[model samples]
Target: MKAFLLLLGCLLATPVLAGPRVELVTSHGTLQLELNEQAAPLTVANFLRYVDDGSYNNSLFHRLIPGFVVQGGGYDSGYSALPSYAPIENESDNGLSNRTGTIAMARTQDPHSATRQFYINLADNLSLDGGRSPGYTVFGRVTAGQDVLTRMARVPTGMNMQLRARDVPDEPITLLEARRLSEQAGGTMTSEPVSKP
Candidate 1:
């Protein structure tokens, strides 16, 4: 009976595995992201909601700054707004930094207003970490396709009249699909057809 209790206790003490990986097939190339649910559960869950519901398919990477971030997951290729769930809590204090290759939520001045929009850091943006304010939540990192993100960073950007936003990619970088890969298939590159700008 003591051995049984010990085994049960050991089983309960085991840590849960990290969240599933998501593959973002974009016009530039594919990027595989490994989410860190253990650190930022709410943020990870919020992102997976969009991925699982196919809401992120056919989306546009509207904002691209050369050495900052590539923001998207809110607008479609036609610049139409995509529906979003309720805002999630600020998980910036989860000890994740806004480092290069890290994927973080994009919010407005309101610290807890992050919904569907997200961005990938092109540089180590440590200033974005929570200090005086609730910083952007870094819930995942790019496990594959760093080169793809590099190519995306070099794309020309300018003011987009349709979005009325600056730093818009001159050539639309559409997220053709966003799907979750099985645990065994995570970080493995698959030969899938990618769309072009």
Candidate 2:
């Protein structure tokens, strides 16, 4: 009986393997994202780098469009932005698709310009997946607090008449904090109030 008990204890003491976790604290509420590193290793590593380096802290969710995506993580509250390093290679070839509740990188016209900015898809964006240009690279998915995203999606937005851009919300939706949740380590990122022009 004593030997059996010792064997059981040893089995119980073994640590279970865990995946990467990302925590997002927004004005609405906090969301915990679990990254599928197996599916997106390079994408996850790049995102974690920004988190650890404080690149995302004090950034604003500058562009929001219901049923489209909520994009942020590179611009300050003032809409002034930091210049990110040369773009990472396009990983759109990854098997992941841009489905609802999935998080993906946002880039300029250049397919590889996706650096620090990211967006959560409110709907399945099939078109974003490599038609002519490379599609957005999906890295993770929301494991919790999706209602907060639903609320953010429903928020009213208007066209930026000056810029002729659509889907700019009247009120600012801030990303209050970001942190890693799983055994894998990362840091939090946030935004400040925007200054007037």
Candidate 3:
């Protein structure tokens, strides 16, 4: 009885901690990103909210630049902007750099305008870091399927008929699903789209 009671006490006193890892089930391939909640708490929370809400399913990676960034998390496969939550505060001051494979929040000219859009840095983008003003928030980095992101970057891009936007992938790179690692089907997070026009 004493040993059992001691074990219970130890269990009660042990802290429970969990970090977030989101699987990006995409057309080009799968990508897994590990968020830095301690460094960018608000940003991480906002991102997880969208992940938890299924807001990102079937979203398009609307912007693609081979050596720059691949942006998404705002549009559906039809190229329409998904309804976004109210903007959140910029966590750019978190000291994370916009380096290769890092993921950052997308915002307008206002530093605190991040809502539901994000981008993956394909190269060291020092210019996007905190300068005279708060830069884009770096909340996470691609932990797996970096090559999948690279493949997405190489996709042909031009003016998109749906968005009438330039630099849009001629062939849409769709995010088919997003989920926590523990909840995802076991497979390579990176695989070419089963089918794409």
Which is the leading candidate under lDDT? 1
The TM-score between candidate 1 and the true structure equals: 0.85
Pairs clashing in candidate 1? none
Best by TM-score: 1
| Sort by TM-score, top down from the best | 1, 3, 2
Whole-model lDDT for model 1 versus the true structure? 0.90
| Per-model root-mean-square deviation over C-alphas | 6.0, 6.8, 7.5
Candidate 3 at residue 29, lDDT?
A: 81
How far in Å is the alpha carbon of 194 misplaced in model 2? 24
List candidate 3 segments past 4 Å from native.
1-18, 183-197
lDDT accuracy of residue 35 in candidate 1: 95
Alpha-carbon deviation at 134 in model 2, angstroms: 2.1
Ordered by lDDT, highest first, the candidates read 1, 3, 2
Please give, for residues 11-34, the per-residue lDDT of candidate 1 as tens digits: 999966656688999999999998
Candidate 3 TM-score versus the reference: 0.82
lDDT of 2 by residue, 1-197 (tens): 99999999999999754457878778878787878778777778888777666667667777788888998887677766766766787788788889999999998888888888899998999888876668888888998899999888877877755436677666777777676653423444333232222
Tens-digit lDDT track of model 3 for 51-92: 878888899889998899999999987777899888998889
For model 3 the local lDDT of residue 5 reads 100
